[model samples]
Target chain A: MNLSRTARALLWAALAGGLGVVYVPLLIVLLNSVNADRTFGWPPPGFTMRWWAAAWESGGVRDALVTSLQAAVGATAIALLLGTMAAFAVQRYSFFGRESVSLLIVLPIALPGIVTGIALNNAFRTVLEPFGVSLGLFTVIVGHATFCVVTVFNNVLARLRRLGASIEEASADLGADTFTTFRLVTFPMMRSALLAGGLLAFALSFDEIIVTTFTAGAGVRTLPIWIFENLFRPNQAPVVNVVAAALIILSVVPIYVAQRISGVEATTH
Target chain B: MFWFMPDQEAAVRLIGLRKSFGPVEAVSGIDLEIADGEFFAMLGPSGSGKTTVLRMIAGFESPTAGMVELGGVDVTRLAPFERDVNTVFQDYALFPHMSVLDNVEYGLRVKKVPRSERRERALAALGSVRLDGFERRRPSQLSGGQRQRVALARALVNRPRVLLLDEPLGALDLKLREEMQVELKSIQREVGITFLFVTHDQEEALTMSDRVAVFDQGRIEQVGTPAEVYERPATPFVASFVGTSNLISGDAAHAVLGKGGTYSVRPEKLRLSDLDAAVGADEHSATGTVAEVVYAGPATRFVVDLDVGGRLVALQQNLQVSSMEVTELRGSRVRLVWNRRHEFAIAS
Candidate 1:
C-alpha cells in the first residue's frame, strides 16, 4: 500500500489525463456554443448568447427535441416491461437453455450498433411493409428498445439475485397468494432497481444516432439525428453547438437520478 | 394436556412423505403424527431432510409422494397461502422495505383483517417476543436478534393451526441463540400452538422440544422424548449424533462386553480412574492407554486407545482435577469403568 511521492504524483497525473481526454471535447463544444465566431475559430475571439437564441427560435430544434423525448420514453417503457420479466424468468426458475436465454437477451447490447441498425432495418422493411407499417418513430423506438432492454435486464437481474426468494416465500407462508406476494413484497423491493434501469434506458435511447438513422423514415427525426444533420450545415453549425451543449446539460438529469436511486439501494441493501 | 380430550385431533400428520429433487431424494419416506400443543423438533445434520419435511408441511414444497395433514384434514395439494400453517425461515426473511410493524401485520392484512385489529395483534405478538418498541424501524435498521423476533412475531400474528420453524435461531450467536430458544419455547406454551421446529443442533432440540425426531440420510432414525433419544438412542446414527457415544461392536463388543452385536455407551457414563481400579460384578471395565486429553473448562474428555481393539472417549467432570493434572494423564495407562446397564445394544 505504501507508495513514493513520485509514484502517487504519477497516478494522480494519469487520472487527470484520462478525465481530460474524455471531457475536453465536451468543454470545447460548450465553449463554442457562445463563441460568437460562426466558424468556431479556436480561442473564440468573443462570446455571445446569439446561438442559444437562434436554437430556441428554431422550430426544427423543438420538433426534434419532442421526437427524441417520445422515442426515449417509449423505448424505456418497453425495456422496463420486457427486461424485468426476462430477468425474473432467468433468475427465479430453472429451465432448459436458461443460461442461453440470458446471453441472448444481452447480445443485442454487445453487438455493434450499426449491425443491429442494419439488421433491424431490413427486418422491419420486410416484416412490416407487408402489414402497411413503415419505418418511422415507432420503428425507431422499437430499435432503441432492443439495446435498452439490456440495461434494465442487467439491473433487475442483479437485484433479484441479491434479494433472494426467501422474503417472497415468507410472504406466501404468511397467507398472501402469488400475486399478492409479488405486488406487496417482490415489486416494492425491485422499485429502485427498475427506476435506475429505466433511467439508464432512457438516457441511452435519447442519444443513440446510428440505430435511429436506420430506423427513422423520412418523416421521423430524433434530436441526435437532427444534431448529426445540422452539424455539417454552414448556416446551422453554431445552432447545432447550442443544441449539443444543451443536451450535454440535460443528459445529466437522468444519470444523476439513476445514480441517486442506485446509491440508496446500495446503502439500504 | 390437550391430548386428554377424547375428540382431539393430531395437530399435524405426514403419511409416507417423500421428496426428491432430480435424482437426489431429500426425504425418502416419512410418517409422523404430532399431538396438539406439543413442541416437536425434527433434529438432523445439514442434508438430513428435516427442513424439507418442514417445508412440505408448510406447503412451500409439495412432497414427491405423500400426504400432509393438518388437524386430520388432508392438505397435500394446498398452496402455502391456503394451508393454515406459517413458517419462520432460518434467515428470518423479514421484508426489508417494510417497517417491523408492517412486516408482522402482513399476514393479517392478507387475511383481510381490519387495520386496527391487525395493528393490535401485531403489537401483541411483538410484545410476546419482547420487541414492542421496534415497530417503526425497518428490518435493515435492526440487529440480527431483533429481525429474528420480527420474523417470529410475523408468523405468530397469523395464529395458524401449526407453526413450522426451520432453524430460526441458527443465525444468532450462541448466547443469543440460547436466550431465543427459551423465549420460543415459552411463546409456544403461551400460544398453545403446535410447533414443528427443525434444527441441526442436538442440544437446541433437547432443550426446547417435548419430543424430537432424529433424521439421517433422508429417513427418520428415531422419534422419542429428549430423554429417550439421548439416554436410549434407537440407532447408531442417533447414538453418535444426539451426543458423544463410544461404539463397542464386532471384536470390541466381544472382547469388552463378552457379546457379539453392537452396543453404545455414552462418554459421560464411563468412569475413568487409575489402571488398578476395582470393578464390581455389575460393571464392565476396559483397560487402555490415554491417547489424548481434551480440557473443556468444566469437563475433560479423554480419548482412550483400548487394549480390546477399539477406542473409547470418556468424559470426566473436572470437579476436583486441575487442567494440568488432566493433561498429564495423556500417555498414561487407565481403566474405563461403567455399569453394565449403561451399555445399550443398538440394533443394526
Candidate 2:
C-alpha cells in the first residue's frame, strides 16, 4: 500500500525496460528508414527518405505486394465463409466425431506453422499433383485458407457461444427460413467478429512465409517472401528494412482496428 | 393474419416429449398444451427441467422422443425459425453489436420484410413496450429491466404466436423482478400471444400465470391453477414447494377421517386455547412452547416446540393479532389455532 520514491522509481524503470525491449527495434526501423548513414544504430547521423523511394522503385517488391494482397483477400474471404459455417456446426449442433472435427479445425492454430506447411506440401505433392492439380495462386489460397480458418473460426465461434439461441429462435418464430435467420439474427450478431476475423486472416496471409514457401509456384512471390529473399542476401537492404517497416505499419493498423472491432473484453472462453 | 397473428390457439402442444443429454434426462415425457393468449408458467427449482421443455418448443433443442405441435401443426422436426415461436432468454441475448432498433427488427429483416416496413413495425413494437425512444441505443446501454423489455419487444415485434420467456425477470433485483412480473403479465395480455413462462420463483408463478406446472426431477409433479396447486397440492413435493407449511407427524390411520392423501394440517388451522387446558392431556392437540418468534413486519412468524411432536412454524398475519398481543416477546407458549379445511392432504 505504501512505497518510497526509490521503490516507485524502480517499478517505473522495470516497466520502461520491458517496453524498450520491443520499442527499440520499432524505433530502429523508423530511424533507419530515414537514416542517410548505413548502420542500424540508436542515434542517426543524418536523415533521408531515399530507402523508402528505393523500396518503392523495386518491381519485385511492388509485384509481390500485389500478389500478397490478392492472395490474402481471396483466402480471407473463403476462410470467413467456411470457418463461419464450421463454427456454427460445431457450436450449435451435436453429432458423431464432433471431438475429432473440433481437433482438426483447431490443429492449424495449435500446431507449429512449419509443421502445417510441411504437411500441406506433402498432401499437395503426393495427392493433388498426381491428379494434375496446379501449384500457384490456387494452391497458395488453399494454404492460406487452412491457417486463416483458425482465426475466422475462433472469432465467429466465440461470438456465437456468447450470444444466446433466443435471438435465432425469435427470428425463426418470426417466420424466417434457415438462410433468413442466418442473415438476420446470426449474421448481424457475428458481423463485427467476422469483419475482424477476415481482416486478421488477411493479415496472416500477407505475412505468412513458411506455408507460402511450400505452396507458392513459379513467379508467385509474396511481399514477405521478397523481404525474406532480399534480407537473406543482404546488400544495403536497409531498403528491405524500410519495406519491413512499411509492412509492420500496415499489419499493426488493421490488427488494432480488428481488436477494437471484435470488442472481446479478455479471453475468448 | 390479423396484425400478423400467425393464427390459432392451443398455440403449442407437447405430446410425450422427452429429451436427454447422454445419460441425463433433462425433460422426461412431458405432455403440455398452452392455449393462445394464456400465460402458463413452469415453476421449479434449478435442474428441474423446466428450461429444457422451453428449449424444445423453441427448436433450440429437439426432443429425443415425441412430437411438438404449434397451431395443430406438427413442428417436431421444424427448425427454430420454422416454428412460429419467439423466446426471451434469461440473459436477454440482444445482439450486442446492433442498435436497439436493429436487435428488435432482426426477426423481421430475416423474413426479408422491406426495410421501410421493418423499420415501421419495429418502432411500433418498441412503442408497445414503452421503449419507443430507445431505437438507436445498444443493449449494453439499457438498464437490466430495460434490456429485458427490449428482448420482449424484439420477440414480440415479429408477432410470433407463442412467446417463450425463460425466467425473463430472473436477472433483475427483487424489487425489479416484482415490477417486471406485473409488466410481463400486462405485456402478454396486450399482445394476446401465448406465453409459456418459466421460472423457479413460486410467488411469481402464483401472481402471473393462468396455470402453474410444478416440476421435480424432470417430471411434472402437479399442474393446475395457482389456487389448486397452492391450496390443494397433490404431492408432498408440491405442498412443501409452493409455500411454507408446518408438518405435524401422526399415525397415518388416525390422522384422517377416512383413507386419504398424507394427512397434514396448516399452522393457522390448529386449535389451541383455554379449551385445550380444560380438555384431557391426551388430546390430539399437543402442547407447544414458543421457541422463537420473529416480527416480520407484515406478519409474526413463530417457531413453536411441541412437547408430543417436534418443532413447527406458524405465520400469523399482524392484521389478525391485535387481541393476541403479538408484541408479547419470545419463549411464550401461545396457542396455534386454525380450521381443518385449511389443511391440504399431500402424499407421504
Candidate 3:
C-alpha cells in the first residue's frame, strides 16, 4: 500500500484542482450577490445587501420559488413510491426481462435531459392536447420525476441487495406472515436508504433547468428557469446571483441530514 | 426422564415425500416418523437432501409428490407461518434492526400476545440461552456464538410443536460447536419438543442426536440410533460417512478376510504390529508395509500398502506409545490384524 511522495503529491494536487473547479463558480456567484458595483466587475468596488433585499421583495422570485418547491415535492413523492416498489420487484423476484426492466427504469436518467425533455414535451402535448389539457406545474413535475426515479431506485436496490431475504424468511418461520415481516423487519431496515434516496431525488428535481424549460408552459417558471432567464438581464443579474447563493446555502441542510441519517444506519446496523 | 406424554402423537411424519427443482430431485422419496419429544437429526453431505426434508417439515418447501404431517395433520401445502414449526437457520438470521429481546419476541408479537407477556417470555427464553442481559443489545453487537444463541432463543420462544435446526452450529468454531451441541441437546430435552436437526458434521449428529437418518443423493441410506448408525452402518455411504472405514472390496476382501464381496472395517478396529509379530490364531490378518504414520495425539493411524493389492488404514490408541514410537513405524513391514467378526459385509 505504499505510495511514493510524488504520487501522493500528484493525488492531492488533483483533488485540490477538482475542488477549485467545482467551487470557484459558486464562490463567484456568492461574491457577485453582494457586489456593490452594478456591472459585477472582476473585483468588487465594495459589498452591499441590496441584491438580497431586491430578490426578497421580487414577486417573480417568490412565485418561482413556490413553483420549484411544488414541483420538487410532487416529483420526489411519486419517485419514492414508484422507485421503492420497482426496487423490491427487481430485488426480490425473478421474472422475464428483469434485467431489461432495471435498465429501462434507469434509462430516463441516463438519457440526456434535453432528449427526455423534448420527448416528454412532445408526448404531453400530443396526448393531452386532444383532451384539452395544457402543460403546467403537473407536466414539469412529471418531467422531473422521470429522471428522479433513477436516484431513488439505485439507493433502494443497493439497500435491498445488502438486506438479504434470510431475515425475512426467518420472520416467516417464526410465525409472522409476509406482510407482518415487511412491516416489522424490512421497513425499519430500509428506512434510511429511502430517506437518502428521497433527499437526492428532491435535490435533483429542485435545481433542474433543461427539462423544466421544455415541460413548463407559459407562466409556469421554476426557480432554475427564472434564474436562467434573469441571469442575462441587466437589472436582475445580481438578484440571480443572490438566488443561486441562497440555493447553495439552503441545499446544505438536506445533504447534511442525509449524511447523518445514513451515517447512523451504518454504525448501528 | 420420560418426557413423552401418553396422549402425544408423532411430532413429524413424512409420507413418501419427494421434492424436485425442474430436473434436479433434491429429495427423491423420504418416509420418516419422528416420535414426540425426540431429538432427531438428518445427517448428510451437501446436496444430500437432508435440509430439504427439514424445510418441507417447516413448511418452507412443498414436496413435489408426498405429504408432510405435523402432529398427525397434513401440512405439506401450508405456508410457513401457518405451520406449527419454527427454524433456527444456519446463518442465525437475527434481525439486525431489532434488539435481542425484540428478535425473540417477534413470533409472540405476531401471535398477538400482550406486550408485557411477550417481554417476559422473551426474557425467560434469553435466560435459558444464557443471554438474559443482552436483551437490549442489537444482534450485530453480539459475538458469533451469542448471536447463535439468540437465534435459538428466538425459535424456542415460539414454543412450536417442532423446532427445525439447519446446521445451527456450523458457523461456530470447534470448541464452541462442541459446547453448543451439549447445550442444544439439553435444551431440547428440557422443552420436550421434537427437534428435526439437519447437519453435515457427522460428529455433531453422532453426539447430539437420539436418532439419525443418513442421506445420500436424495435418498435415505439408513436410519438408527447414533451407536447403531456408526458401529452398524446399514449402507456403504453410511459406513464411510459416519466414520473412517477401510472399504476392502473384491480381491482385497477375499485376501484379507476370505470374503468374496465388499466389507468395511473401521480404522480403529484394526491392530498393527511389526511384520514378524505373532497374531492371534482367530484374528483376520493382512500383511503390508507401513506407507505412512499419522500422529493424531490420542490415536496413531498407519497407512499400510497391503500385499493383497490395496491400502488399509489401521488406527492404534496411543495408550503407552510416544510420538517417536509411532513415527518409527513408518516404512516398516507390518501385519494388520482385526477380529474376523469386526468385518461387516457392505451390500453394494
Candidate 4:
C-alpha cells in the first residue's frame, strides 16, 4: 500500500484535475448568475442579485417549472406501476420470451434519446391522429415513461431476485391469501426499492429535453425546453444562468434521497 | 405395518399422489397414511421427492394425480391458505423486515384475530421456543439458531392440525442441529399435533420421528419405525441410505450365508476377530484379509476382503483397542462374525 512521495503527489494531482473538470463549469454557472456584466464577461467587474430577482418574477419560468413537475410526476407514476409488474413477471415466473420481455423493457433507456423521441413521435402521430388526440403534455409524459420504466424495472427486479419466493410461500402457508400475502409480505419488502426507483425516474424525466422536444406539440414547454430556448435570447441570458444555477442546486435532492434509500437497502440485505 | 394403526383416524393421507415438472417426474405415485398426532418423517437424499410430497400435502403444489386428505377431508385441490396446515420452510423464511413478534403474529393478523389476543398468543409461542425477550429485534439481528427458533414459533403460533417441516435443521451446525432435534420433538409432543417432517439427515430422522418413510427416486422404499428401518431395511437403497450396510448377493450370498438371494448386514453388527475364530451354531462367519482400516474416534472400521469373492466392512468399538493396535491389523487375516438373525434378506 505504500507509495513514493512523488507517485502519491501525482495521484492527488490527477484526482483534483478530474474533480475540477466536472465541477468547474457548475461553479462558473453560479458565478455567472450573479455577474452584473449582462454579457457574462470574464471576472464580471461586479456581482448583484438582479438576475435572481428577474428569474423569480418571470411567469414563463414558473409555467415551465410546473410543466416539468407534472411530466416527471406522471412518468414516475406510470413507471412504478408498469415496471413493478414487469419485474415480478420476469423474476418470479417462467413463460415464453421471459428474457426477451426484460430486454425489451430495458431497451428504451439504452437507446439514443433522439431515436426514441423520433420513433415515439411518429407512432403517436399515427396512432393518436386517428383518435383525434394530439401530442402535448400527455405525449411528453408517455415518451418519458418509456425510458423511466427501465430504472424501476431494474431496481424491483434486483430486489425480487435477492428475495426468493420462500417468505411469500410461508405467508400463504400461514393462512394469508394471495392478495393478502402480496400486500402484507411482498409489497413491504420491495417498498424501499420502489421509492428509490421512483425518485431516480422522476429526476431523469425532470431534466430531459430531446425526448420532450419531439413528443411535445406546440404550446407545451418543459423546463429544460424553456432553458434551451432562452439560452440564445440576448435579454434572457442572465436569467437563464440564474435558472440553471437553481436547477443544479435542486437536482441534488432526489439523487441524494435515492442514494440514501438504496444505501439503507444494501445494509439491510 | 407396525407403525400404522387402523383404528385411529388418519391425520393426513395421500392416495396415489403424483407430481411432475416437464420431463422430470418428481413424485411418481405415493400413497401414505399418517396417524393422528404421530411424528412422521419423510427421509431421503436431495432430489428424492420427499420435499415435493410434503409440498403437495401442504397444498403448495397440486398433485398431478390423486388426493390429499386431512382428517378425512379431501384437500388435494385446496390452496395453501385454505388447507388447515402450515409449513416451516427449509430457509426458515422469517420476514427480514418485521420484528420477531410481528412475524409470529402475522398468521393471526391475516386470520383476523384481535390485536390483544394475537399478541398474547404470539408471545406465548415465542416463550415456548425460548425466544421471549427477542421479540422486538429484527430477524437480521439474530443468529442462525435464533432465526430458526423464530421460524418455528411463527409456524407453531398458527396451531395447525398438521405441521410440515422441510429440513428445518439442515442449515444449523451439528451441535445446534442435535439440540433443535430434541426441542422439535418435545414441541411436537407438547402441542399434540401431527408433524410431517421432511429431512435428508438419517440420524435426525431416526432420533425425532415416531415413524420414518425412506424415499428413493420418487417412491417410498420403506415406511416404519426408526428401529424397523435400520434393523430391517426393505430394499438395498434403504439398507445403505439409512445406515451403512454391506450388501452380499449372488455368489457372495451363497458362499457366506449358504443362500441364493440378496442380504444386508450392518457393519456394526459384524464382529472382527482372529481368522480361525470359533463360530456358534447360529452364527455366520466369513474369513478374509483386512484390506483397509479406518480409525474413527469411538470406533475402528475394517474393510475385509473375503476369501470367497466379495468384501464386507466390520465396525469394532475402540473400547479396549488402541489406535496403533487397530491400524497394525490392516494387512492381517481376520474373520467377520455375526448372529444369523442379523442378516436380513432383501427382495430383489
RMSD of each: 2.2, 4.8, 2.8, 2.8
Residue B274 lDDT, candidate 1, scale 0-100: 85
Window of ten residues with lowest summed lDDT in model 1 chain B: B1-10
Candidate 1's C-alpha lDDT? Answer: 0.93
Tens digits of per-residue lDDT, candidate 2, A57-88, equal 98888999899998999899899999999998
* Residue B233, model 2: Cα distance from true site in angstroms: 1.2
- Could you give candidate 2's per-residue lDDT for residues B61-110 as a string of tens digits? 88999999998889999887677788898888777767999888888877
Model 4 CAPRI rating = high
- Give each model's whole-structure lDDT: 0.93, 0.81, 0.90, 0.93
Candidate 4 lDDT over residue span B150-197, tens digit each: 998999898988999999999999999989999999999999989999
Tell me the TM-score of each prediction against the true structure.
Answer: 0.96, 0.83, 0.94, 0.96
Could you give the TM-score of chain B for each candidate, in order? 0.97, 0.89, 0.96, 0.97
Q: Give the range where candidate 3 chain A is weakest over 10 consecutive residues by summed lDDT.
A: A249-258
lDDT of 3 by residue, B199-261 (tens): 999999999999999999999999999989988888888888999868888898876777698
Candidate 3, residue B66: lDDT: 94
Any runs in candidate 3 off by more than 4 Å, and if so which? A1-14, A41-48, B1-6
Better of 1 and 2 by TM-score: 1
DockQ of each: 0.90, 0.42, 0.79, 0.85
Model 3 per-residue lDDT tens digits across residues A1-269: 89999999999999999999999988998999999998898789998999999999999999999999999999999999999999999998899999999999999988999999899999999999899989999999999999889888998998898888888889899888889988998998888999998998888898999999999999899998899888788888889989999888767677788779878877776
Model 2, position B292, has a per-residue lDDT of 76
Docking class of 3: medium
Q: In candidate 4, which residue ranges exceed 4 Å CA deviation?
A: A1-9, A41-47, B1-7
